[model samples]
Target: MPVPPPLRQRILITGASAGLGREMARAWAARGRDLALCARRPDALERLRDELLAATPSAVVSLHVVDVADHEAVDAAVDDAAAALGGLDRVVVNAGVAGGDSLGLDGAEANRTTARTNFLGAVHQAESALRVFRPAGAGHLVFISSMSALRGMGGAMNVYSATKAGVSALAEGLRSDLVGTGIAVTAVHPGYVRTEMASHFPRMLMASDPDRATRAIVAAVEREPARAYVPALPWAALAWPMRLMPLGLYRRVAG
Candidate 1:
Protein backbone atom coordinates (compact mmCIF):
# COMPACT_ATOMS: atom_id res chain seq x y z
CA MET A 1 0.00 0.00 0.00
CA PRO A 2 1.13 3.53 -0.70
CA VAL A 3 2.18 5.41 2.41
CA PRO A 4 -0.15 8.04 3.79
CA PRO A 5 0.99 11.60 3.32
CA PRO A 6 2.44 13.51 6.22
CA LEU A 7 0.10 15.73 8.20
CA ARG A 8 -0.23 19.24 6.79
CA GLN A 9 -0.55 22.04 9.32
CA ARG A 10 -1.97 25.10 7.67
CA ILE A 11 -2.83 27.11 10.77
CA LEU A 12 -5.26 30.03 10.64
CA ILE A 13 -4.94 32.75 13.30
CA THR A 14 -7.19 35.79 13.69
CA GLY A 15 -5.93 39.09 15.16
CA ALA A 16 -2.52 38.29 13.81
CA SER A 17 -1.42 41.90 13.48
CA ALA A 18 -0.25 42.38 17.05
CA GLY A 19 -0.30 41.18 20.66
CA LEU A 20 -0.44 37.47 21.43
CA GLY A 21 -1.79 36.67 17.97
CA ARG A 22 1.24 38.20 16.24
CA GLU A 23 3.60 36.29 18.50
CA MET A 24 1.79 33.06 17.75
CA ALA A 25 2.17 33.65 14.03
CA ARG A 26 5.89 34.24 14.40
CA ALA A 27 6.41 31.28 16.72
CA TRP A 28 4.41 28.87 14.55
CA ALA A 29 6.13 29.98 11.38
CA ALA A 30 9.53 29.44 13.01
CA ARG A 31 8.58 25.76 13.32
CA GLY A 32 8.25 25.63 9.52
CA ARG A 33 4.46 25.47 9.52
CA ASP A 34 2.54 27.44 6.93
CA LEU A 35 0.20 30.07 8.39
CA ALA A 36 -2.96 31.95 7.41
CA LEU A 37 -2.80 35.29 9.22
CA CYS A 38 -5.74 37.68 9.51
CA ALA A 39 -6.24 41.03 11.26
CA ARG A 40 -8.05 44.32 10.75
CA ARG A 41 -4.81 46.15 9.97
CA PRO A 42 -3.79 45.39 6.43
CA ASP A 43 -0.45 47.17 6.71
CA ALA A 44 0.48 45.30 9.87
CA LEU A 45 -0.52 41.98 8.32
CA GLU A 46 1.67 42.63 5.28
CA ARG A 47 4.59 43.69 7.47
CA LEU A 48 4.27 40.54 9.58
CA ARG A 49 4.09 38.35 6.48
CA ASP A 50 7.25 39.94 5.19
CA GLU A 51 8.99 39.49 8.55
CA LEU A 52 8.02 35.82 8.78
CA LEU A 53 9.12 35.06 5.21
CA ALA A 54 12.40 36.86 5.74
CA ALA A 55 13.13 34.74 8.80
CA THR A 56 12.28 31.48 7.04
CA PRO A 57 12.10 31.76 3.28
CA SER A 58 10.54 28.28 3.04
CA ALA A 59 7.55 29.11 5.27
CA VAL A 60 4.19 29.88 3.71
CA VAL A 61 2.42 32.89 5.21
CA SER A 62 -0.85 34.10 3.70
CA LEU A 63 -2.31 37.41 4.88
CA HIS A 64 -5.94 38.54 4.98
CA VAL A 65 -7.34 41.84 6.16
CA VAL A 66 -10.26 40.95 8.36
CA ASP A 67 -12.45 42.50 11.04
CA VAL A 68 -13.69 39.65 13.19
CA ALA A 69 -16.82 41.63 14.08
CA ASP A 70 -17.93 41.31 10.46
CA HIS A 71 -19.30 37.79 10.29
CA GLU A 72 -19.57 37.60 6.51
CA ALA A 73 -16.06 38.97 6.15
CA VAL A 74 -14.76 36.42 8.65
CA ASP A 75 -16.37 33.61 6.69
CA ALA A 76 -14.92 34.82 3.44
CA ALA A 77 -11.44 35.40 4.86
CA VAL A 78 -11.36 31.99 6.53
CA ASP A 79 -12.57 30.28 3.36
CA ASP A 80 -9.99 32.01 1.22
CA ALA A 81 -7.18 31.24 3.66
CA ALA A 82 -8.17 27.59 3.98
CA ALA A 83 -8.26 27.35 0.21
CA ALA A 84 -4.82 28.91 -0.07
CA LEU A 85 -3.44 26.65 2.63
CA GLY A 86 -5.03 23.54 1.06
CA GLY A 87 -7.42 23.15 4.00
CA LEU A 88 -6.82 24.29 7.56
CA ASP A 89 -5.29 22.05 10.18
CA ARG A 90 -6.12 24.53 12.94
CA VAL A 91 -8.10 27.73 13.51
CA VAL A 92 -7.18 30.01 16.41
CA VAL A 93 -10.01 32.36 17.29
CA ASN A 94 -7.66 34.87 18.90
CA ALA A 95 -9.33 38.11 17.93
CA GLY A 96 -10.89 39.93 20.89
CA VAL A 97 -11.45 43.37 22.45
CA ALA A 98 -10.99 44.16 26.14
CA GLY A 99 -12.95 47.39 26.40
CA GLY A 100 -16.37 47.62 28.02
CA ASP A 101 -18.58 49.58 30.43
CA SER A 102 -18.35 50.23 34.11
CA LEU A 103 -21.66 49.84 35.94
CA GLY A 104 -23.69 53.09 36.04
CA LEU A 105 -21.82 54.40 33.04
CA ASP A 106 -22.76 55.25 29.45
CA GLY A 107 -20.45 52.72 27.78
CA ALA A 108 -23.16 50.60 26.26
CA GLU A 109 -21.69 51.04 22.81
CA ALA A 110 -18.34 49.86 24.05
CA ASN A 111 -19.91 46.81 25.65
CA ARG A 112 -21.89 46.07 22.50
CA THR A 113 -18.80 46.28 20.35
CA THR A 114 -16.97 44.00 22.72
CA ALA A 115 -19.85 41.54 22.72
CA ARG A 116 -20.09 41.51 18.94
CA THR A 117 -16.36 40.97 18.56
CA ASN A 118 -15.59 38.60 21.39
CA PHE A 119 -18.71 36.44 21.41
CA LEU A 120 -20.50 36.64 18.08
CA GLY A 121 -17.23 36.95 16.23
CA ALA A 122 -15.96 33.78 17.85
CA VAL A 123 -19.21 32.00 17.07
CA HIS A 124 -18.78 32.81 13.41
CA GLN A 125 -15.23 31.49 13.40
CA ALA A 126 -16.28 28.27 15.07
CA GLU A 127 -19.03 27.71 12.53
CA SER A 128 -16.66 28.40 9.66
CA ALA A 129 -14.02 26.10 11.13
CA LEU A 130 -16.52 23.29 11.53
CA ARG A 131 -17.59 23.60 7.93
CA VAL A 132 -14.02 23.10 6.80
CA PHE A 133 -13.25 20.34 9.29
CA ARG A 134 -16.43 18.25 9.29
CA PRO A 135 -16.07 16.96 5.77
CA ALA A 136 -12.30 16.71 5.91
CA GLY A 137 -12.71 14.82 9.21
CA ALA A 138 -9.95 16.69 10.97
CA GLY A 139 -9.08 20.13 12.36
CA HIS A 140 -8.21 21.90 15.60
CA LEU A 141 -10.36 24.67 17.02
CA VAL A 142 -8.49 26.87 19.49
CA PHE A 143 -10.33 29.51 21.50
CA ILE A 144 -8.33 32.26 23.18
CA SER A 145 -10.09 32.91 26.43
CA SER A 146 -8.83 34.88 29.46
CA MET A 147 -8.17 33.97 33.08
CA SER A 148 -10.85 36.50 33.93
CA ALA A 149 -13.37 34.05 32.46
CA LEU A 150 -13.12 31.95 35.58
CA ARG A 151 -15.74 34.21 37.17
CA GLY A 152 -17.58 37.48 36.58
CA MET A 153 -15.09 40.31 36.72
CA GLY A 154 -15.74 43.93 37.77
CA GLY A 155 -15.68 47.39 36.23
CA ALA A 156 -14.30 47.59 32.70
CA MET A 157 -13.39 43.94 32.74
CA ASN A 158 -17.03 42.95 33.24
CA VAL A 159 -18.05 42.56 29.64
CA TYR A 160 -14.67 41.29 28.55
CA SER A 161 -14.86 38.64 31.22
CA ALA A 162 -18.39 37.74 30.27
CA THR A 163 -17.46 37.37 26.63
CA LYS A 164 -14.52 35.15 27.43
CA ALA A 165 -16.77 33.07 29.62
CA GLY A 166 -19.13 32.73 26.71
CA VAL A 167 -16.33 31.55 24.44
CA SER A 168 -15.10 29.08 27.05
CA ALA A 169 -18.58 27.64 27.29
CA LEU A 170 -18.72 27.53 23.52
CA ALA A 171 -15.45 25.61 23.40
CA GLU A 172 -16.75 23.08 25.89
CA GLY A 173 -19.96 22.63 23.91
CA LEU A 174 -17.97 22.10 20.75
CA ARG A 175 -15.81 19.51 22.48
CA SER A 176 -18.90 17.61 23.62
CA ASP A 177 -20.38 17.75 20.14
CA LEU A 178 -17.19 16.73 18.37
CA VAL A 179 -16.23 13.79 20.53
CA GLY A 180 -14.99 10.75 18.58
CA THR A 181 -14.72 13.04 15.59
CA GLY A 182 -11.36 13.97 14.11
CA ILE A 183 -11.93 17.64 14.88
CA ALA A 184 -10.57 18.68 18.30
CA VAL A 185 -11.37 21.76 20.39
CA THR A 186 -9.22 23.47 22.98
CA ALA A 187 -9.62 26.58 25.17
CA VAL A 188 -6.62 28.58 26.37
CA HIS A 189 -6.87 31.02 29.26
CA PRO A 190 -4.07 33.52 29.17
CA GLY A 191 -3.31 35.81 32.07
CA TYR A 192 -1.85 39.32 31.83
CA VAL A 193 0.35 39.06 28.80
CA ARG A 194 2.32 42.19 27.95
CA THR A 195 0.39 43.45 24.94
CA GLU A 196 -0.82 46.75 23.60
CA MET A 197 -4.27 46.06 24.98
CA ALA A 198 -2.91 46.21 28.51
CA SER A 199 -0.27 48.85 27.97
CA HIS A 200 -2.11 51.53 29.87
CA PHE A 201 -2.54 49.47 33.00
CA PRO A 202 -0.66 50.73 36.04
CA ARG A 203 0.87 47.30 36.28
CA MET A 204 -0.08 43.90 34.94
CA LEU A 205 -0.99 41.10 37.31
CA MET A 206 1.39 38.17 36.92
CA ALA A 207 2.28 39.46 33.50
CA SER A 208 4.32 37.43 31.04
CA ASP A 209 5.70 38.67 27.78
CA PRO A 210 4.08 37.71 24.50
CA ASP A 211 6.93 35.40 23.44
CA ARG A 212 6.83 33.35 26.62
CA ALA A 213 3.07 33.17 26.59
CA THR A 214 3.14 32.07 22.98
CA ARG A 215 5.54 29.26 23.85
CA ALA A 216 3.17 27.91 26.45
CA ILE A 217 0.19 28.34 24.15
CA VAL A 218 1.90 26.49 21.32
CA ALA A 219 2.87 23.66 23.62
CA ALA A 220 -0.63 23.32 25.01
CA VAL A 221 -2.13 23.49 21.53
CA GLU A 222 0.11 20.73 20.21
CA ARG A 223 -1.12 18.45 22.99
CA GLU A 224 -4.72 19.40 22.14
CA PRO A 225 -5.94 19.68 25.71
CA ALA A 226 -9.60 20.44 26.35
CA ARG A 227 -8.50 23.41 28.49
CA ALA A 228 -5.18 24.95 29.44
CA TYR A 229 -3.71 28.00 31.15
CA VAL A 230 -0.94 29.51 29.16
CA PRO A 231 2.42 29.60 30.96
CA ALA A 232 0.52 27.50 33.55
CA LEU A 233 2.25 29.14 36.45
CA PRO A 234 0.52 31.44 38.97
CA TRP A 235 -2.57 31.77 36.76
CA ALA A 236 -3.49 28.10 36.80
CA ALA A 237 -2.99 28.01 40.53
CA LEU A 238 -4.58 31.40 41.07
CA ALA A 239 -7.74 30.62 39.10
CA TRP A 240 -9.27 28.48 41.86
CA PRO A 241 -8.91 30.99 44.65
CA MET A 242 -9.83 33.87 42.39
CA ARG A 243 -13.10 32.14 41.60
CA LEU A 244 -13.84 31.37 45.22
CA MET A 245 -12.88 34.74 46.69
CA PRO A 246 -15.72 36.65 48.33
CA LEU A 247 -17.04 39.62 46.44
CA GLY A 248 -15.80 42.18 48.92
CA LEU A 249 -12.30 40.77 49.04
CA TYR A 250 -12.27 40.36 45.30
CA ARG A 251 -13.33 43.92 44.77
CA ARG A 252 -10.67 45.23 47.13
CA VAL A 253 -7.97 43.18 45.45
CA ALA A 254 -9.12 44.09 41.97
CA GLY A 255 -9.36 47.73 42.89
Candidate 2:
Protein backbone atom coordinates (compact mmCIF):
# COMPACT_ATOMS: atom_id res chain seq x y z
CA MET A 1 0.00 0.00 0.00
CA PRO A 2 1.15 3.54 -0.73
CA VAL A 3 2.07 5.66 2.24
CA PRO A 4 -0.53 8.25 3.24
CA PRO A 5 0.42 11.87 2.78
CA PRO A 6 0.84 14.01 5.87
CA LEU A 7 -2.28 15.96 6.83
CA ARG A 8 -2.11 19.77 6.94
CA GLN A 9 -1.90 20.50 10.65
CA ARG A 10 -2.02 24.30 10.85
CA ILE A 11 -4.85 25.88 8.88
CA LEU A 12 -6.16 29.40 8.27
CA ILE A 13 -9.80 29.89 7.27
CA THR A 14 -11.55 33.17 6.41
CA GLY A 15 -15.31 33.68 6.92
CA ALA A 16 -14.99 31.40 9.88
CA SER A 17 -17.72 32.94 12.05
CA ALA A 18 -20.40 30.75 10.50
CA GLY A 19 -21.55 28.68 7.54
CA LEU A 20 -19.16 26.41 5.64
CA GLY A 21 -16.01 28.05 7.03
CA ARG A 22 -17.10 27.42 10.60
CA GLU A 23 -18.11 23.86 9.81
CA MET A 24 -14.84 23.22 8.01
CA ALA A 25 -12.98 24.55 11.05
CA ARG A 26 -14.86 22.09 13.24
CA ALA A 27 -14.09 19.24 10.88
CA TRP A 28 -10.39 20.10 10.85
CA ALA A 29 -10.26 20.65 14.61
CA ALA A 30 -11.76 17.20 15.15
CA ARG A 31 -8.74 15.84 13.34
CA GLY A 32 -6.37 17.79 15.64
CA ARG A 33 -5.61 20.66 13.27
CA ASP A 34 -4.67 24.05 14.75
CA LEU A 35 -6.87 26.78 13.29
CA ALA A 36 -6.75 30.54 12.79
CA LEU A 37 -10.34 31.67 12.25
CA CYS A 38 -10.95 35.07 10.58
CA ALA A 39 -14.26 36.89 10.25
CA ARG A 40 -15.79 40.33 10.76
CA ARG A 41 -17.75 39.33 13.83
CA PRO A 42 -15.51 39.19 16.86
CA ASP A 43 -18.22 37.76 19.12
CA ALA A 44 -19.06 34.96 16.78
CA LEU A 45 -15.39 34.18 16.29
CA GLU A 46 -14.91 34.10 20.04
CA ARG A 47 -17.83 31.70 20.50
CA LEU A 48 -16.56 29.39 17.81
CA ARG A 49 -13.03 29.51 19.22
CA ASP A 50 -14.34 28.56 22.62
CA GLU A 51 -16.56 25.81 21.24
CA LEU A 52 -13.76 24.23 19.24
CA LEU A 53 -11.24 24.46 22.05
CA ALA A 54 -13.71 22.95 24.51
CA ALA A 55 -14.57 20.09 22.22
CA THR A 56 -10.97 19.42 21.21
CA PRO A 57 -8.72 20.39 24.05
CA SER A 58 -5.56 19.66 22.11
CA ALA A 59 -6.37 22.11 19.29
CA VAL A 60 -5.21 25.74 19.02
CA VAL A 61 -7.95 28.09 17.77
CA SER A 62 -7.13 31.76 17.28
CA LEU A 63 -9.59 34.42 16.17
CA HIS A 64 -8.95 37.36 13.87
CA VAL A 65 -11.62 39.95 13.14
CA VAL A 66 -11.22 41.05 9.56
CA ASP A 67 -13.10 42.23 6.53
CA VAL A 68 -11.50 40.31 3.67
CA ALA A 69 -12.24 43.12 1.21
CA ASP A 70 -9.43 45.14 2.85
CA HIS A 71 -6.09 43.88 1.57
CA GLU A 72 -3.94 45.42 4.29
CA ALA A 73 -6.11 43.95 7.05
CA VAL A 74 -6.04 40.56 5.38
CA ASP A 75 -2.25 40.66 5.09
CA ALA A 76 -1.83 41.53 8.75
CA ALA A 77 -4.35 38.90 9.85
CA VAL A 78 -2.77 36.10 7.81
CA ASP A 79 0.68 36.95 9.17
CA ASP A 80 -0.63 37.16 12.71
CA ALA A 81 -2.44 33.84 12.43
CA ALA A 82 0.60 32.14 11.00
CA ALA A 83 2.70 33.39 13.87
CA ALA A 84 0.10 32.30 16.42
CA LEU A 85 -0.13 28.78 15.04
CA GLY A 86 3.67 28.42 14.60
CA GLY A 87 3.27 28.12 10.80
CA LEU A 88 0.49 27.65 8.31
CA ASP A 89 0.19 24.36 6.48
CA ARG A 90 -2.96 25.41 4.61
CA VAL A 91 -5.16 28.43 3.88
CA VAL A 92 -8.84 28.33 2.87
CA VAL A 93 -10.01 31.45 1.04
CA ASN A 94 -13.72 31.11 1.78
CA ALA A 95 -15.01 34.60 2.63
CA GLY A 96 -17.62 35.85 0.14
CA VAL A 97 -20.83 37.78 -0.37
CA ALA A 98 -23.92 36.89 -2.46
CA GLY A 99 -25.47 40.35 -2.76
CA GLY A 100 -26.21 41.36 -6.35
CA ASP A 101 -29.20 42.25 -8.51
CA SER A 102 -29.98 42.47 -12.22
CA LEU A 103 -27.40 44.39 -14.22
CA GLY A 104 -28.00 48.03 -15.37
CA LEU A 105 -31.07 48.27 -13.14
CA ASP A 106 -29.47 50.50 -10.50
CA GLY A 107 -27.69 47.48 -9.04
CA ALA A 108 -24.15 48.52 -9.86
CA GLU A 109 -23.25 48.97 -6.20
CA ALA A 110 -24.58 45.57 -5.30
CA ASN A 111 -22.79 43.90 -8.20
CA ARG A 112 -19.57 45.68 -7.36
CA THR A 113 -19.84 44.68 -3.72
CA THR A 114 -20.14 41.05 -4.68
CA ALA A 115 -17.25 41.33 -7.11
CA ARG A 116 -14.88 42.98 -4.63
CA THR A 117 -15.70 40.63 -1.79
CA ASN A 118 -15.73 37.40 -3.75
CA PHE A 119 -12.98 37.93 -6.31
CA LEU A 120 -10.74 40.71 -5.05
CA GLY A 121 -11.01 39.43 -1.51
CA ALA A 122 -9.94 36.01 -2.70
CA VAL A 123 -6.99 37.58 -4.48
CA HIS A 124 -5.87 39.31 -1.30
CA GLN A 125 -6.13 36.10 0.70
CA ALA A 126 -4.21 34.12 -1.91
CA GLU A 127 -1.46 36.75 -2.13
CA SER A 128 -1.00 36.81 1.63
CA ALA A 129 -0.98 33.02 1.94
CA LEU A 130 1.63 32.59 -0.78
CA ARG A 131 3.86 35.13 0.99
CA VAL A 132 3.95 32.79 3.99
CA PHE A 133 4.02 29.55 1.99
CA ARG A 134 6.86 30.38 -0.41
CA PRO A 135 9.58 30.39 2.19
CA ALA A 136 8.22 27.22 3.81
CA GLY A 137 8.19 25.43 0.40
CA ALA A 138 5.02 23.56 1.41
CA GLY A 139 1.39 24.61 1.84
CA HIS A 140 -2.09 23.93 0.57
CA LEU A 141 -4.12 26.85 -0.82
CA VAL A 142 -7.83 26.13 -1.22
CA PHE A 143 -10.30 28.42 -2.95
CA ILE A 144 -14.02 27.93 -2.44
CA SER A 145 -15.47 28.54 -5.85
CA SER A 146 -19.01 27.65 -6.93
CA MET A 147 -20.61 25.27 -9.43
CA SER A 148 -22.09 28.41 -11.00
CA ALA A 149 -18.54 29.13 -12.26
CA LEU A 150 -18.87 26.44 -14.94
CA ARG A 151 -21.10 28.70 -17.07
CA GLY A 152 -22.27 32.28 -17.29
CA MET A 153 -25.37 32.94 -15.24
CA GLY A 154 -27.89 35.75 -15.49
CA GLY A 155 -30.24 37.74 -13.23
CA ALA A 156 -29.16 37.89 -9.56
CA MET A 157 -26.53 35.24 -10.11
CA ASN A 158 -24.82 37.24 -12.84
CA VAL A 159 -22.08 38.96 -10.86
CA TYR A 160 -21.83 36.25 -8.24
CA SER A 161 -21.16 33.58 -10.86
CA ALA A 162 -18.68 35.79 -12.66
CA THR A 163 -16.63 36.31 -9.51
CA LYS A 164 -16.51 32.58 -8.87
CA ALA A 165 -15.30 32.05 -12.40
CA GLY A 166 -12.45 34.47 -11.75
CA VAL A 167 -11.64 32.66 -8.54
CA SER A 168 -11.49 29.30 -10.34
CA ALA A 169 -9.24 30.77 -13.01
CA LEU A 170 -7.05 32.36 -10.35
CA ALA A 171 -6.57 28.99 -8.67
CA GLU A 172 -5.70 27.34 -11.97
CA GLY A 173 -3.18 30.04 -12.79
CA LEU A 174 -1.57 29.70 -9.37
CA ARG A 175 -1.41 25.92 -9.71
CA SER A 176 0.33 26.31 -13.02
CA ASP A 177 2.78 28.86 -11.60
CA LEU A 178 3.64 26.64 -8.63
CA VAL A 179 4.21 23.46 -10.67
CA GLY A 180 7.68 22.76 -9.36
CA THR A 181 7.13 24.18 -5.85
CA GLY A 182 5.99 22.02 -2.95
CA ILE A 183 2.91 24.22 -2.49
CA ALA A 184 -0.42 22.84 -3.80
CA VAL A 185 -3.51 24.70 -4.96
CA THR A 186 -7.07 23.48 -5.04
CA ALA A 187 -10.24 25.13 -6.35
CA VAL A 188 -13.39 23.54 -4.95
CA HIS A 189 -16.48 24.27 -7.00
CA PRO A 190 -19.33 23.43 -4.71
CA GLY A 191 -22.87 22.78 -5.87
CA TYR A 192 -25.87 24.23 -4.05
CA VAL A 193 -24.86 23.81 -0.47
CA ARG A 194 -27.39 24.92 2.16
CA THR A 195 -25.79 27.72 4.18
CA GLU A 196 -26.35 31.35 5.16
CA MET A 197 -24.66 32.45 1.96
CA ALA A 198 -27.03 30.39 -0.19
CA SER A 199 -30.15 31.15 1.86
CA HIS A 200 -31.33 34.02 -0.34
CA PHE A 201 -30.76 32.26 -3.64
CA PRO A 202 -33.39 29.94 -5.02
CA ARG A 203 -32.36 26.45 -4.06
CA MET A 204 -31.20 24.37 -6.99
CA LEU A 205 -31.62 20.66 -7.71
CA MET A 206 -29.53 18.21 -5.64
CA ALA A 207 -28.75 20.81 -2.97
CA SER A 208 -26.65 19.38 -0.16
CA ASP A 209 -27.07 19.95 3.56
CA PRO A 210 -24.20 21.58 5.48
CA ASP A 211 -22.81 18.50 7.20
CA ARG A 212 -22.50 16.44 4.02
CA ALA A 213 -21.18 19.42 2.07
CA THR A 214 -18.52 20.16 4.69
CA ARG A 215 -17.43 16.53 4.64
CA ALA A 216 -17.04 16.63 0.88
CA ILE A 217 -15.21 19.98 0.98
CA VAL A 218 -12.82 18.82 3.70
CA ALA A 219 -12.17 15.56 1.92
CA ALA A 220 -11.36 17.39 -1.30
CA VAL A 221 -8.99 19.80 0.52
CA GLU A 222 -7.19 16.85 2.06
CA ARG A 223 -6.64 15.41 -1.38
CA GLU A 224 -5.31 18.83 -2.55
CA PRO A 225 -6.38 18.29 -6.16
CA ALA A 226 -6.08 21.06 -8.75
CA ARG A 227 -9.87 21.28 -8.91
CA ALA A 228 -12.72 19.39 -7.32
CA TYR A 229 -16.45 19.48 -8.05
CA VAL A 230 -17.50 18.96 -4.49
CA PRO A 231 -19.69 16.05 -3.42
CA ALA A 232 -18.01 14.52 -6.49
CA LEU A 233 -21.22 12.76 -7.49
CA PRO A 234 -23.70 15.07 -9.22
CA TRP A 235 -21.54 18.21 -9.58
CA ALA A 236 -18.58 16.25 -10.97
CA ALA A 237 -20.89 14.48 -13.40
CA LEU A 238 -22.66 17.72 -14.36
CA ALA A 239 -19.54 19.84 -14.97
CA TRP A 240 -19.11 19.25 -18.70
CA PRO A 241 -22.83 19.07 -19.43
CA MET A 242 -23.41 22.32 -17.61
CA ARG A 243 -20.59 23.95 -19.52
CA LEU A 244 -21.91 22.70 -22.85
CA MET A 245 -25.62 23.30 -22.34
CA PRO A 246 -27.28 25.82 -24.62
CA LEU A 247 -28.05 29.17 -22.96
CA GLY A 248 -31.81 28.75 -23.13
CA LEU A 249 -31.79 25.22 -21.72
CA TYR A 250 -29.02 25.90 -19.22
CA ARG A 251 -30.98 28.77 -17.69
CA ARG A 252 -34.06 26.58 -17.27
CA VAL A 253 -32.15 23.67 -15.72
CA ALA A 254 -29.87 25.73 -13.52
CA GLY A 255 -32.27 28.45 -12.41
Which candidate number would show the highest TM-score if scored against the true structure?
2
The ten-residue window of minimal lDDT in model 1 covers 197-206
For candidate 1, write residues 1-255 as lDDT tens digits.
999977657999998999999999999999988999999999999999999999999999998888888888988998999889988999999998877667679878888999999999999999988999999999999999988788887778888889999999999999999998999999999988889987754437789988899999999999999999878997888878988999889877763
In candidate 1, which residue pairs get closer than 3 Å at backbone N, Cα or C atoms, i.e. clash?
none
Off by over 4 Å in 2: 1-8
Candidate with maximal lDDT: 2
Over all chains combined, what TM-score does candidate 2 have? Answer: 0.96
List candidate 1 segments past 4 Å from native.
Answer: 1-5, 201-203
- Quality of model 1 by C-alpha lDDT: 0.90
Q: What C-alpha lDDT, on a 0 to 100 scale, does residue 215 get in candidate 1?
A: 96
Q: What is the TM-score of each candidate against the true structure?
A: 0.95, 0.96
> How good is model 1 by TM-score?
0.95
Q: lDDT of each structure?
A: 0.90, 0.93
